[model samples]
Target: MTPLSPDILDAVAHGAHHDPHSVLGVHESSDGWVIRARRPLAAEVVAVLDDGTAVPLTHLRGGIWEATVESFPGRYTVRATYDGTEHVTDDGYRHSPSIGELDLHLIAEGRHEELWRVLGAHVREIDGSQGVAFTVWAPNARAVRIKGDFNGWDGSGSAMRSMGGSGVWELFVPGIGVGTRYKFEILTRGGQWIEKADPMARAAEVPPATASVVTDTAYEWSDDAWIEERSRTAPVDRPMSIYELHLGSWKQGLSYRDAADQIIDYVGAQGFTHVEFLPLAEHPFGGSWGYQVSGYYAPTSRFGSPDDLRYLIDRLHQAGIGVIMDWVPGHFPKDAFALARFDGEALYEHPDPRRGEHKDWGTLIFDYGRNEVRNFLVANALYWFEEFHVDGLRVDAVASMLYLDYSRNDGEWAPNQFGGRENLEAIRFLQEVNATSYKRYPGIAMIAEESTSFPGVTAPTSAAGLGFGFKWNMGWMNDSLQYIGRDPMYRSHHEGELSFSFVYAFSENFVLPISHDEVVHGKGSLFGRMPGDHWQKLANMRAFLAYMWGHPGKQLLFMGQEFGQMSEWSESRDLDWWMLDQPAHRQLHGFVAELNRVYKDHAPLWSRDHDGAAFSRLGAPAWNPNVLAFARRDHHGNTVAVICNFSGVPLGDFPLDLPESGTWTEVLNSDAEAFGGSGQGNLGAVTTDARGSATLTLPPLGVLWLHHRADA
Candidate 1:
C-alpha cells in the first residue's frame, strides 16, 4: 500500500474528516495512480474501470481499501462484497462538488434570493450520471453524513465534505433518484451525533416519520393570463371576499388535487374572489394546524406531493380565483428532529432564553438579528410567490413578533437598546420581507395579522413604515362580535361597540377577518355566539354578514360559518358539512352566496374603501330602535345605503336620509324570506320626498341595502 498520513487515515476511519473526498477517491501518488474506497462490513473491495477491468484492492486499517493501478481510468465503479453478496455502484466521491463557488459566495453574504435552488436535496444529472445531490448548512458541526434507505439507514460510507468557511456540506450520490428518503447525521462540536430533517426540503414524510424526500417538479403552469391580469390590478381596487379554510379539516381524507376540484367550484359559485388556506408548510403535529412549521419550503405531505400542490394552485387560477396562504415566521416548535438544537447549538434561534423562547407557546423564537436567518425567512416569502404562484401571504401572529414583552411578566423580558419593548430586528426583518416581496412580484398582497396600535403598519417601506399591503381589523372583529352576542335590549346601550370601528376605518388598509382563531379554542362556533333561540340566531347572523360586506374594507369568512355549523372548529375532524341538509342551514348558505353577489356587483362598497369621504353616517345611533344606518360612496359618485336593525320588533315609518334619490330600490334584503327571515321590508322600492328622505318598514333583526336607479 502507498504511504499515507496516519492521522488522515484515522480521521477517515472514524468518519471525522472535514474533507473526506481528498482521501477517498482516486488520487495521483508518486508510484502511479492509487484508488481508495471505504466500505465498512465488507469482506472484499474491487475497482471496476469503464473498460470493464476489475482489480482487487488490499484491505488497509479501519474500513479503508486501496490498490495502486498502472494507469488512470476516466470513470470507475466500486464493487464490495457484503455478507457473501457483491454490490456494485458508481463511486459517490469521484464527482466534483455539486454547489459552485458563486453559490457559496452568495450564501455567505446572505444574499441568495433563490436559496432553495442550491440548499435542499435535488435530483440532478451530472457528468452523465443520474443521482440526487444533497446540501445543507451546518457550520458548527464537526462532520456531517447522508443517511437514508439507499444505505440501509447507515452513513459510514456517505460522509460529506465541508465547503471551506461556507458552513455548507454536500455530496452527490450517483445511484439514488427521486422519492428517496434522507436526513443529515451531524457530528456536533460536542462529539454527539444527531439526525435532522432538511430545513429546505421540498417534500417531507407524513408525521410520526421525519425523513426528507428527494423531489423535482415538471408541472406546466396554465396561469399566464391570470398572472398578467393580476400584475396589472391592485388588490384594493378589486372586490375581494375571501373564503378561508383548513385543507385537512375541510374534507378529512382529500388530497390536494381532490380539494382543488371541489374548492374551485364552491368558491366560484359563491362569488368569492379569493381563497385563503391555513399554513400548508410541513409540520409534525397535526393539532398545530401547520403553524409550527418543520419544513419551510415543503408543501405538507399530509395532502400530497409538491407538484400536486402546484396543480391545485394552477387550477384555482384557471377558474379566476386567487390563492393566499398563511405564513408563520414568528416561531417554531421545539421538536428534536427539526431545527431545535441543530449543530448542538442555537443555530436558528436566539441564544438568550428571554429572547429565544416562547413560554406561552412552548416554541423557540427566531433570531431575526442574524443575517442568514433573516435571509431564510425573506427568501421563503418569495419562494411561495415564485414557485407556487400564490397571490398573497397572510402573515400570522405579527404582534408576537413585534413586542419583546409579549405575554411576559415584568422581569421575564429585556428591553431593546432604545429602552423600549419593540423588537427592532424583527421590525427590520418584516420591512425587508414585505419590500422584497412587493418589488419582485408586483400586485402581490402582504397582509399582517397585527392586533396592536402599532403605527404605519400598512404604510410604504420607503417612508420608514412596515410596508404591509393590509392589516387585519382585529379590533373591529372583537367589538362587532361582542356587540352582537348581547341581548337585543342591552345591545342598544352598547351601540358604541358597533359604530366605533368607523372612527379609524381608513387609518390603514384593512381586512375585516372572521378568522379560524375566533372559532376555536373553546370559543364556540360563530352561530353559537349570537345570544338567541335558533331562529333569531340565524337572523342575527344574516344581519351581521350584510353589515360586514357593506362596511369599508375587504372581508374574510372562515369555513363552515356560511351554513351555520353548530360546533366549534376542530382540526381532528372534518367540518359539519351535513348541516346543510336542514332547511335553515341551506337557506343561510344561499344567503351568503347572495350577499357576495350583491357585494361584487356594487362598486360603491369596495372601490373607495381607504378614503374617509367614501363613508358617512345617516344619523345618530337610534338608541331605542337599535338601528344603525350608513352610506358608502364610490369615486364615480355611486352610492350604497345600508340599514341594520338589531331589535326583535319591526319599525314602521322609520325615516332615513338618502344620498340623492327620486326612487331607491331595495338591492338586497336579509328579510326576503329566501334567507329564512320574517320577509318585512320596503316592498320593492321607496320614493323619496322633496328633502331626499324616505319612510320604510325595517325588518326585525335584519339588514337592507338600497341603491338609487339612474332613471329615477
Candidate 2:
C-alpha cells in the first residue's frame, strides 16, 4: 500500500482526520512525491502530472487511491473513472495556500475588522485554476469537512485541515464555483457527525431549507453619487422622517427588485427621507419576522439573492432615499444547524446556560467576551454597510445585550466581575464595534433600540458612552401610547405622560419610534388604541402623530399606521392596504404625506433636534391643560410652531408664546374638512403681537402647524 499507515486508512474510511491535507493532497513521502484522493465511486484512479507523465495509483482498501510521481508538487490532474464515466479534474490540493498567515493571526487575535474578506467561502484562483477558499472558526470540533454539492454528499472525502494553533479550518477546493450549495460536516469530540449551515454564508437556500450557497459578490454599484453625498452628511441635525416597514409583509410575495421600485415610489411621493426594513436577514421561521436570525450574513433568499437586495438598496439610493435595516445581534435562534453549540460545545455562546441563554427569547446569547465571537458579530455589521450599501443599522434588542439580567430573574442570571448586573464584556464589544464602524464608515448612522435608563447611549465613545449615533425613544412611545389611549376625560390626570419626553429628550440623539411592536401581539394598531368612536380615533391618531413629528427628535412610524390600520399588525398578510378605500383612511394617508413634506421643508423642526434651545413649550400642558403648544427654532430664528388640543371642545382663543413677531400662516391643520375633520382653524394667517405671542383658534382633536410668514 505504498507504506500508507493503517491509521491513515482508518481516518479516510471513518472521516475522523483533523489534518486530511497532510495525507490526501500532493505530499512529499519517503518515495519522492505522491498524490492521493478518496474516490469511493471510482473504479480506477490515476495521477497525471503537468508534463503528461501518467502514474497509475494503487487502490487502497477505503476507496483511497494514490500514486508516486517523480515530479515535486506542481500543476497536476487526477483522472477517476466510474462505471462508464471518466471524470478529469485538476488536483484540488496542489495549490498555494488560499488564506495568508497574517489573516490567520488577525483572526486569532480577533482584530480582523474585515474578516469577511479573509474567512468564509471565497472564490480565488490558485495555481492557474479557479476554485473556492473555504474557512470557518470551529475550535471545539474534532474534524471539519466541506460538504459541497459537487462532493456527492461525501463526509469522508473532503476533510478540511485545521490551521496550526488557530481554531480556523480551511480548504482550497479546485473547481468549486459560485452557486455551489455547501455546508460544514463536523465530527464531534464524541464521534457523532452533524451538518451545519455556514454562519457567515453570504447566500442561503430559501428557508425550511438549510443549505448555504456560495455567492459571487461582484456587484456593479450604480450609487456612486449617492454614496459620495452620504459620506459628507449624517442624519443628525437633518430632517429624518423614516418609514419603517416589515419587508415580507409590506406588499407580500414580491422580489427585492420589484418591491424596491414600488416602495421607493411610495416613500418618495410621501416625502420620506428614508425607508427602514424590519430585519431582512435570513431566518428559518417567517413568524419571527426575521428577528430570530439563523444566517446573519445572508439576505433572506425569499426576496432573491444577495445581489437582488443590493439592487434594491442601490435603486433606493438612486431615487434619493436612504435604506436602513434592523439588525438583531442580541440573541440568535437555537436552531440545531445554526450557531447554537456551533462546534459540539458552546463555542459561540457562554458555556453556562444562566449566562448564555435568553429564557424569554428562547435563544442563545453570544459570548461577547470571546475574541472570535466578537469579531464575527462586529464584522457582520460592517458587511451590511460596506457590501450592501445600507445607510444605517437599527440595532434591535439593545436592552437585552446591555444588561446581564435582561429578561432573567434573580438566581437565573449572573453578575459581572464588578458584581453588577451589567454585561461589561458586551458593553466593550459594543463600544469597539461602534468606534470601528464610525472610523471605517463615515456618516453611517449607528442607532440603538434600547429601552432602558442606560445613560449616554448616543454620546461619543471618547466621552464614556455606547457611541451610538441615535437611540430610539421607546419610553416616549410607551408613555404617549398609554396617555393617548385614555379618554379625553381622564387625560388630565395623566398629563405628565404627554409632556414627559422633554425631560430627557436631549439626553441622547432620539428617534421617536412608533414601530410595529406597538401594534402587534394583541396591542392593537395605533388607530385602534385611541379613545373614541371611529372618527375620534382617527382624529386622535392624526393628532398624536403630528405631535410626534413636532417633538424634538427624529421620527420613525411603522407602515399602515400612516393610513390608520384598524386591526393589529400581522406579518402573515399585507398591511391593511384596503383601508385606503375609506375616505377617513385616505385622508389620514394624505395627512401623513403632508406631514413628511412639512417636516422636510421646515429646518427648525430638525436642525437642532439634540439641543434644548431649539425647542420650548408654547402653551404649557397644565394651562387649558388639554391644549399643548411648542415652538421649534433654528440658530437664526424660530421657523415654526405647533399647537394641539385633545379635548372634545374647541377653544375660541387659544394663546401660544411664539418666538417670532410675524404673520403666522396656518401651514397645516389636521382638522381640515379634507382630512375628515370638522374644518376648524384660523383663516390662513394670524399676526403675532410685539411680545412674540399669538392667540389662535384651536380645534378639538386637532393639530395646527404654523410657519412664520415674514412676507404676509
Candidate 3:
C-alpha cells in the first residue's frame, strides 16, 4: 500500500483519527450535527476498515480531502496512498483533543459549567411503562433535576438519579411519554436555575408561541409506494423545476389540505417536480417566518395539524412531486418559558456572551459542543424523512451558524484560537449532522441556504465536504436580479453579469431561486419590478423568466410568479387572482405556461451534469454588451439554442450560429402576439439554415427558443 501523505497524517493527527473510537467528535449546529476532518487519503478512504477496501480520488488538494463523514463515529483508521506507499494511523498515534486541553480552555471551561451537561441529552428511550428515561452529560453539575408540565413545572420532586462514570445523569418519570413537555433544572458552579429543554427532546409544546406537545407515535403511512418508486429512480437531475413557497400564504382561505390540492394541481400543470416549503417546524412567532423555532419535532399547527401536514407531503409524493422542508437550527428565540430559561440558567447556551448571544437576530445561539444537542438535531433531520416522508431538507441560515462573527465586528465578536470567524463547535456539529443523516439514508437530499462564500457547502461527506446535496446560488439570484431589473441601456453595458455564476456551478449543485423573501417588505412582486410601459414590462418579465428557466442551476419560482400576481405577498391576504382577468396580465400567464411547456418538453434542459452549452462576453466587464446565450444538448446530439434580447429596442437581424444545418423552428417566442407582444414575430414558423448558421430577427426584451430536428 502507498504511504499516506504527511499532510494527511497531520490532519488525521489533529482531527480525523481520535481515541475512544470517536473518529469524529459529536457536536450540534443550527442545521445539524456536522463532522469535520482534513481531507482524507483519497482512494485510501475506504468504505470498510479492511486493507483492500479503497476508493480513489480524482484529485487530491493539499494531500487532504476535507470532508464531512456521517459515519465517522464508527471504528476506522485514516490511510493514504502517496507514491504507492500506504500509511495508516494506528492506536499509537491516536490523540484526542479535550475541552480542558485546548488553548480556548477558559471558554470551554465556562461552557462546561452547565451548557455542556445539558447538551448531551441523547439516548432517550422508554424506561418503564409510564416513565420516560432522560439522561444528560454535565459531569460538573452539582445537581440535575427534571422539570416541565409533567412535573408540575418543578424540578425538585422528580429530580434525576446521577449516573456516575459517564458524566451522565438519568431520570425516570412515572407518567411521562412523548407528548409530556419537559426541561432540566441543574445546579452548576454559577448556582442558578438553568431551565433548558431536554437536548434529546423529540417534541415541545410551549404556549403563546407554539402550544402543546404530543407523544411520539407511529403513523400508518401509505408512503411505502412513494419510497419504493423513489428508490427505483436516480432522482430527477433534470426536470427539477421547484416552486419555492411559504405554506401559510400559498393560497387564500385554503387549509393545508386545500393548499396542497391546489398547489399540486397547479405545479403538475406547470411541470414542476418539487415544492420547497419555507420552514415547517413550529416556531414561536409568525413574523419570524418560522426561523425562530420552539418545537423541533412538531409541524407548525398554524398551517394545520401534524397529521394534516403529513397528508400534504404524501399527496405531493403521489403527484410525482418531491417535498423539501426548510430547516432552521441556527438559533433559538429568547422566550422565557421555552428553551431559553429551561432550568433557569444558561444551560443550552454559552456562558460566554460571545458564544451565547447572536446580536444580529437577537437570539441565543446553541451550544453545539454537547453530544445530546447533536443527537437531538440529527434525529430531527431524520424525523422529517421518516415521519413526514420528506424527500429533502433545506438548511436555513447556515452562514450565521458557521461563523462566530457572522454579523459582528473585530472588537464586537469573539474569535477562535486561530483568529478565524469560524465557530469550531458549530462546524463540528454541522459535519456530524450531515454525516449521520446521509449515512442512514443515501438518497435523501440535504440543502444549504448559506450566504457566505464557504467552499464545499454541498460537497460529499466522504470528501471532508459539508455533505449537502445542493446549495442556494445566492450569486445567481443577486446577479440575475440586478441585471434583469435594470434598463435595457444599462443592462447592455452590464451584459457580463450572468458569467459570474459559472465560477462555482461545478463545485456543488446550485438552486437558482426567486424566493418569497424577495417580494416582501415593499419590494413588490416580480411583475412590478419592471421599469417600462405595461407591454414593455411584461415583455421584460417574460425575457427574465425564459432566461431563468434556461440557466444552468435548478429552478425555483416563488408562488404567484406563474400566475402573474400583482401585489406583494402577505400572510393575512391571498394572491391577487383578480389581476388575471386583465388582458395584459393574462398575456404574462399564457407566456409563463408556454415557458413551462418548453422547459418540460426539452430533454437538454433536464440534464444537470454541467455539460451544456454556455457563452458570455470574452473580456473587460464594462466594455462588454449585456447578453447570455446557451444550448441544452441531448444524448442524440440534438441541441436547442436559447437567445435573449435584454434591450428595449429591436436588434434588426441578429447573427447566430447553429450546431447543425437545418430548418429551425421557433417552438416558443416570448415576442409573439399571444404573449402580450406587439405582434412583432411570426409564431410556429421555421427558418432554413444550410451553413449550420442563420441570421434571425432579435426582438427587444424577448426570448427566442429554436429547435432543430434530426432530419433538418
Candidate 4:
C-alpha cells in the first residue's frame, strides 16, 4: 500500500474526507481543473499546490487552461502572464485549497459533530435584563460564563448553567438593555479559557472596539402609512436608483439616526428609490470596511443603539426609501473577544491551515460544511430582514465565500471537488439564506457583490440559482471607468467599453456602481480617475455619467459623487465641501443632478423590455467622432435619444439619425449655463429633420437629451 502523506492522514483524521475515495476531488478521470480568461488573453502560467507542489497550467481551449498533479489535499495558487509578459498580473485572485482534520474528542451533546453545530447550541442571557437570549452548541464546556461590561468585566453573574443531556446551557437576566456589552467565558474539558461574543446580541460596541452588547430591540415604527406604500417589491421596470453610502463617513460623524435623517431627506428630494449602506455588523477593525465581521447578531454600536438603527430604518421607510445593509458572512476577524480562540481552539474555523485562513484579507474563514454554521448564517440573514425591517441586504465579498482558493500564493490555499475553487458548502448556505429570506419576507431583496464570473447568482432558486435579486456589475464598472479616463484620441480603440458589458448584462439584474472600493488605497477620487485639463476632466466626467445613467442596468453612486467632492473619502473627517467653489467641480455636480432629474422623468431610462434599437444602429464616427448615440423606447413605442461627446473640441453640424420628421427639443445638456457650463449652445431647444437624420452644433465634451415633438 502507498504510504499516506501527513496531509492525507490529517484530512481524514479531522473529518475533512467525506467521500472516502477522493482527496482534493482529483479522481483519475479528472486530474485538473480549468479556468477561462476574459479578454487580453494571458500568455504564460504557473501553478502550485498547498504542499509546495508546482504544476504548469497551460492555455488550451477557448481561453481556458488546465493542469493536474499527484495527491495533494490543500489549496493552490497561480500567476499568469499579462501586459506583454512584462507585467505580472495581480487581480487579487486565488485558486483552490483543501483541509485536514484531527481526531480529538473534547465534549459532545452526543458525539461532537461539525464545528458549526458544536458552537451553535448553547444559550446565554443577561441577568435581570430585557435584552438578548441566544444559544450556541458547545456540548463540551465544563462551564460557560457570560462576560463583558454588563457584568462589570466579570462572568460570575448572568452565567450559563448546563441543562442535562440536552447538551445545552441556559441563562436569563434583566436590566441589560441596548448597549450593555457582553462576551462568553467558556471553560472546556481541557481546562482552557475561551472568550467569545454573545452570538445573538443585537448591537455591539464596534469602534473604540470592545465586547459585544445585549440589546432588547423594540421600535415604535410611526411609518405604517409609509410602509404600505413600499411593502411590495418595486417593479423591475421602474428606475432603480440606489444611493450608496458608508454609515460611518458619509455625513460627517453621525449616528445611524443622523445618517438616516440626512439620507432619507436627500433620497426624497433627489428622486432615488433606494439607500444602500455599507456593512453595519460588529467588527473588530473599522478599516476592513466591516468585511472582518465578528458578532453576526449585533449591529455596530459605533453608529448607535440597536433601536436607534431600527429607528433609522423606520425614518427611511417613512420617506418611501428602501434600505439595504451590507452583510459579510465570508470571514471573521481573529480577535480574542471574537471567534478566534473560542473553545480554546479554532472552533468556528476549519482545523486545516488551508481552510482556516483567508490569505487576501488575512482573516479566519468559517467552516461552512458544519450544519450549525450554515444555520447560524442563515438565521442571521433572516434575522436582519425580519427583526430590523431592512428592505434588503447587500452581501459583501461573496466571491471569496464561493471559492476555496482565493488569494492564496503558490502552495498556499486549498481545493474542492473537481480540483476547482467552488466551495459547495458555501454555495449551499447561500441558497439556504436566499430561500429563507424570500419565503419570510417576499419584499426584501438580496444583492451580491460577487466579482468572480459566477453565473446565475441572481437567477431563480427553482432554476438552481443562488437567488440574489441583483449583483454588482464589476466588469462594467472596471471597463467603463478605464475607458472614460482615457484621452479622446485613444478612446476609439476602447469605444466598445459600454457595449462590451452587454454580453453579461442580461444574465442578472446588475447595479452599475462607482462604490467605495474604487475611491481608496491610492485609486484617487471619481473625478480624479479621469484624464485631461480641468475643463476636459469635467467634460469627460459628464460624458461618463450620462452614459452610465443611460446604460441597461440599475444605478448606484457613492455618497459624495453627487456633489463632485474632489478629495478621497476617509472615515476620519467630512468630505471636501470647499471643492464645490471651483467651476469645473461645480459643473460635474450640476450634471449629476440633471442626470438624476432626466432619469426620474423619462420612462425610457429604465423601462423593461428595452428597445433593442437602443444599443444598435449607430452612425459612423466622423459625424461626431467623440460622441456615442443611442435611443431607449418605452412600451408605447415612444423613443428618447441620448448623445455624449467625450472630446475637448467643439463640433458643429453633428449628424444624428432621426426617428421622425418633426422638430427635436434639447431637453437636457450638461453644458447649460445654470450648471456652470459655458452656455455655448441654444439654451432651451433645437430642431431636427425627417430624412432619417438631422444636424446640430455640440459643445466640447457635452451630452444632450433630445425628445421628439410633432410641431417645429
Candidate 5:
C-alpha cells in the first residue's frame, strides 16, 4: 500500500496540511497506484471504482485508510461504513482547483474587475462533472471548508485547499447543484473555527436565514434596445426628474414584478424620467432600508430572485423609465454570520475599531486599503450594471467614504499618509471605480450623494475630479427647506437662503434633491413643513416645487412628496396611498405631473440648466424675501419667467424685467384652486408694454410661470 506515511497521516488527521490532495487522493508510487481516504469514525473504508470494484482498505491510525490498486482508473469513490451507517462520497481531493493561477495573480494584484466570477460559490461543470466550484479569500484562515445542505451541513468530508501564497481557498464538489445553501467553514489563524457567508455570494437566503445560496444569474434580458439607446445618448443634457422610493414600502402586497409595473406606471404617469430605488442589496434588518448590506452581490431576496430584479429593471426600461440604484459601499452590517470577523479575524474590515466602525450607524466600514476588498466593491458595482442592466448608480453616503473623520470627533479617527482627514485609499478606489465604469458603460450615470464641500465632486476624472456625473445638492435642499418653513412675515430676512444656491449652482452637475432624508427622523414631510393653514401650505409646496423645476439643476423627490402625503415615510408599511382620494392630495399630485411635463416640454427650462447666462434673477435677493422672480432662457432666446409671492396676502403691480415686450401667458398658478389653491391668479394673459418689463397682480402665497404668448 506504498507504506501509508505516518507523518502524512498525522497531517491529514490534524487538518494542518496546505494540500490534502497529496496524501488523500489516489497517487502512483514506484510499485503501483495507492489510494488513501479519511473517514474519522468509520469501522471500514473501501475504495469503490467506477465499475463497482470494491477494494477493502487497511486501517491506519487516526482514520487513515489505504489500499493498493493494480492501475489507476482515474475516477473512483470512497465508501465509509460506520455503526449502521454507510457514507458514499466522491474523492474531493482528486479534483483540480477550480481557480486558475492567473486569476490568483490578478486577485493578489487587485486588478480583477470580474472578481465575483472567481471568488464565490459557482455552479460549474468541472472535469465533465456538474457541481459547484467554491472559492473564498480568507487570508488569515488556517483552513477553509465548504458546508451545505448537500452534506448535512458538515465540513469534515472536504476541506478546501489553499492556493500557495495567495490566501485563496478553492474546492470543486461534484454533484452539488444550484439552490444549494452553503457557507464557508474557516479555521482561523487564531485556531478558532467559524462559518461565514460568502462575501461575493450572488444570492443569499433572504435574511432571517443567513446561508448563501448557489444561483445561476442566467436570466434572459429584454433591455437590449434600452441599453443600446442608453449607450448612444447623453444624460446630462436631458431632463431627469427622479422619484426616489424604497421598494419595500412603495406599495402594499407587491413583489418585485408587481412593483415594477406599478412603479413604472406611476413614475411614467407623473412624467418623471427616472426612478431612484433605495439600497436594494441583501440586508438583514428591514429597518436599515437595505443600507446595512450583508450580501453585496445578492439583490435582497425580500423582493424576489436576482432574475426577478432583472425583470423589474427590464419592465422599467420597457416603460421608458430609467432605473438608478442606491449603492452603499460605505459600510456593512456586523452580523456574526456575515463579514464580521470573517475567518475569526478582521478580514473584510480594518483592524482598528476607530477606522473600521461607524458608531452612528452601528456598522463596520470597509477596509478600502486592501486590494481584494477594493476588487470586491468595484466588481459589485459592475455586476449591478451588467447583470441587472440598471441605468445608473447613486452611490450612497459618499461623504462618509471621503472623510476619515466623518461622524467622529478629535482622537476618534485616523489621518491619511498626507496627514489629511481624507481617506486616500477610499479616494483612489472611488476614482478607479468611476473611471472604469465610465470607460466601460458609456452613457451610464454615476451619481454621488456627497453632502460635504469636498470640491470637484462631479468633475471628470481626467481633470483630477471625482468623475461623478451628478451630486445630490444637499445644501440647496437644506437651505430651501429651512427658508420655506418660516412664516412669510419674516421670510425676506432669509431670502439669501434661496439665492445663495445660484452662486454655486453651476459649480457641479447637481441634482436638487428633496429626498427621504429630508422628511424622516422628526424632520416632517415637505407638505407639513410650510407654515400656516392648509391652503397656504399647499400653495407654498406648489410654489417651492415650481421653483425647484425652474432652478438650474435636475430634480429628485421622494415617493410620497408628489401627492403631498402628510405622514412620514416608513420602511415597514406603504405610503398613505389612500390620501390620494383627497382633493388636495390629487391636486398636488397633478401639479407635480404638470411641473414635470412643463419642465420636459420647455427647452429653456432644462437646456440651459447649468449655464449662468441662461438664468438671470429679477428684482433683488432681499428686496422682498416674500417675493422673488427669475427668468430662464433657451439657446434661441425663448424665455419663461418664474415669479413667486411667498406671503399670505396678495400683492399688486409687482413689476419684473421681461426678456421681451408682448402678451405674456401665466402657464401655472399655485393658487389656481385646481391644486387646492385659493383660485386667485392672473388672468390667462396680460399685456407688457414696450419697455421689456411686465407689471402684474400676484396671487397670495402663489408662484407664476409666464412665457411670451408667441413662444407659449
Candidate 6:
C-alpha cells in the first residue's frame, strides 16, 4: 500500500479539509491504484467494486482507512461495519462535481439569474444513483461540511470541496433523497464552528426549527390557460381589486391545501381579481408576518411544503384569481443560524453598520453593492414567479431600499459618491430586478410598496426610472382615511384631505390601498375609523369605498374590512369572521360584492384608468354639502358618474351636471335598504335636461353609481 501523509489523513478525518474528494476517493499512484475511506466509529471498512471484488481496507488512524487495488474501480460501493452491523452505500466521493463550469463562472460573476438551482441543497441524481448535491457560498470559511439527519447531525466524514476563487463549497452525497433535513457546519477562520441554513433552500423546516430541507417538487399545474392569458394581458390595463390577507390569520390552523378552496371561493365570491398575501417566505417569528425573511427561496414550511403553496396558487389560478406575494428584499433578521455574520464575517449583509443595519426594524440590510448578494435577491424574485406561478410581487419597504438615510439620523448614514442620500447600488439592483422580471415574465406585475415621492417609480427602466408596474398610494390612503375619520359636522372644512388624492392620482400607476397597515398598531379597523354611531359608521364606510372604487386607480382592501370588521387586525388569531352573523355586517359584505361586480362590469371604471382625458371633475367640491362627484369615461364614450354625500342629512334636488343629456340609471345606491342603508335614493333612474343637468335626491352619508343608458 502507498503511504499517505498523516496530516492529510487527519484533515480528512477531522472534516477540516477543503478538498476531501481528492484524498477520500480512488486515486492512482506510481505503483498502483489506492482507495481511501473515512467512516467514523466503524470496526471495519471495505470497498466493493462493480466487478464483484470486495477488498478489505486497513484502518490507519482517526477513522481513516486505506487499501491498494490492482486496478481502479470505476463504480463502487463502500461497506462499513459498525458494532458488527454492516451497512452498504454508494461512495459519495467517487462521483464528479455536480455543478458545471459555466454555472460556477456565472455564479462567480454574480450574473446567475437562476442561482436557486445551483446554490441550495437539491435532490439530484448522479450516475444513476439518487442523492443530493449541496452547495453554498462562504469564501471566508476555513471549511464546510454537510451535517444532517443521515449523519447523526455530524459532518466528520462529509467535508465538501471548495471551488477555487468562487467562494463556493459543494458536496454530492449518495443515498440521500428528498425530505432530508440538513444544515451546513462551517469552520470559520477563527477556528469556531457555526451552523447555517441554506440561503437558497427551496424548502425549510417550520420556524423554531431552522434546517434546510432537501426537497424536490412534482406538482402538476392545471393553470396553463391562466398563465397563457396572463402573458398577453397587462395588469395596468386589467381590473385589479386586490384582497390583501395574512394566510395564517385568515383562518387559524389551516395548511396551504386546506385553505386553498376556502380562499379561492371567498375571494372569487367577493369579486376580487387578485389575492395579495403577506410575505410567504420562511421567517422565524410568525408575528413578523414574514417581513423578516431568513430563507429567501423557501416557501415558509408553516403552510406545508413548497409544493403545497404551488398547489394553492394553482387552484386559485384555475379559479381565475391571480396571486400576488408580498416580497421583502429590504432586510433580514439577525438570527445566529441565518445570514447574519455568515462565513465568520459580514457576507450577505453590509459590513458597515450605517448602511447595513435597519435600526427601526432591528434587522440587517443586504449588501446590495456586492454582485453575489444582488444576484441572490434578484433571482429570488424570479424564483417566486417561475416556481410558484405567482402573478405579481408587491415589494415591501421599497423606500427603505432607495434611501441610505431612511429612518436614520443625518450622522448615522453615509452618502453616495455624488454626496446624495440615494443608495446607487440598491437603485441599480431594483432597476435590474424589475427590468429582468418584466423581460422574462411579460404580464407579471412588479408593484412597489413605496411611500415616498421617488420620481418615476412606475416609469420604464429604459427611461432611467425604477420601472415598477404599480406603487401603493400611501398618500391617498392616509389623506382619505384621515378625512373620513372626522365627525360629519366638521368634514366640510377638510374637503382637501379627501379631494387631494385626485391631484396626483395619475402621477404613477397607483393602488389606493386600505391595507393592513391602516388597521393595525392601535389604528382600529376601517369600520372603527369612521366617526359616528353604528348606523352612520356603516354609511360612511360604504360611501368611502364607493369613492375609492370610482377614483382613478386600482384598489386593495385588507381582510375583514370588506365586512366592516370592528377590531384592529391581529396576526395571532383569525379575523372576526363571527361578525358576519350580524345582519348589518352581512349587508355590508353583500354591498361590497355587488360593488365589485359593478366595478368589473363597467369598463369606464378601469379600462382608461390612467388616461387624463377619461376622467373629469363634476363641478367643484361642494364643501358645505360635504359632497363630491366625478365622471369616468371609457374609450367607447360610455360614462359613469359617481356622487358621494358625506353629510348626516339627505339633500333633495341636488343639482349635478351630467356628461351627456339622457337617462342615467341608478346602478348602485349605498342608501338602499338591501345594504342596511336608510333606503333613500333617486328612485332607480333619472332624465337629464338638454343642458346635461339632473335634479337628484342624495342619501345621507351615502354614494351612488349612475350609469348612462345607451338606448336613451
Which candidate leads in TM-score? 6
Error of 2 at 684 (Å): 1.5
| CA error at residue 219 for candidate 3, angstroms | 2.2
- Compute each candidate's TM-score over C-alphas: 0.97, 0.97, 0.75, 0.77, 0.95, 0.98
User: Which one wins by lDDT: 1 or 4?
Assistant: 1
Q: Write the per-residue lDDT of candidate 6 for residues 40-89, one digit (tens) a residue.
A: 78998999989889999999878988888877778888999999899998
| Model 1 poorest ten-residue lDDT run | 617-626
If candidate 1 were superposed on the true structure by all CA atoms, what would the RMSD be? 1.9
> How does candidate 1 score on lDDT?
0.91
lDDT ranking from best candidate downward: 6, 1, 2, 5, 4, 3
Candidate 2's TM-score:
0.97
The residue-level lDDT of candidate 6 at 252 comes to: 97
lDDT by residue for model 2 (259-344), tens:
98899889998888999998999999999999999999999999999999999999999999999899998999999999998888
- lDDT scores of the candidates, listed in order: 0.91, 0.87, 0.65, 0.66, 0.85, 0.91
Predicted candidate 1 versus true structure: per-residue lDDT over 285-390, tens digit per residue: 9999999999999999998999999999999999999999999999998999998878889988999988999999999999999877888899999999999999
For model 5, how does the per-residue alpha-carbon lDDT over 105-193 read when each residue is reduced to its tens digit?
99998899888889898888866677889999988888888888987898766678889787898888888888999988888777777
Look at candidate 4 and tell me the lDDT of residue 89: 29
What number of clashing residue pairs does each candidate have, in the order they appear? Answer: 0, 0, 54, 35, 1, 0
Cα distance off (Å), candidate 3, residue 559: 1.6
TM-score of candidate 4 against the unseen true structure: 0.77
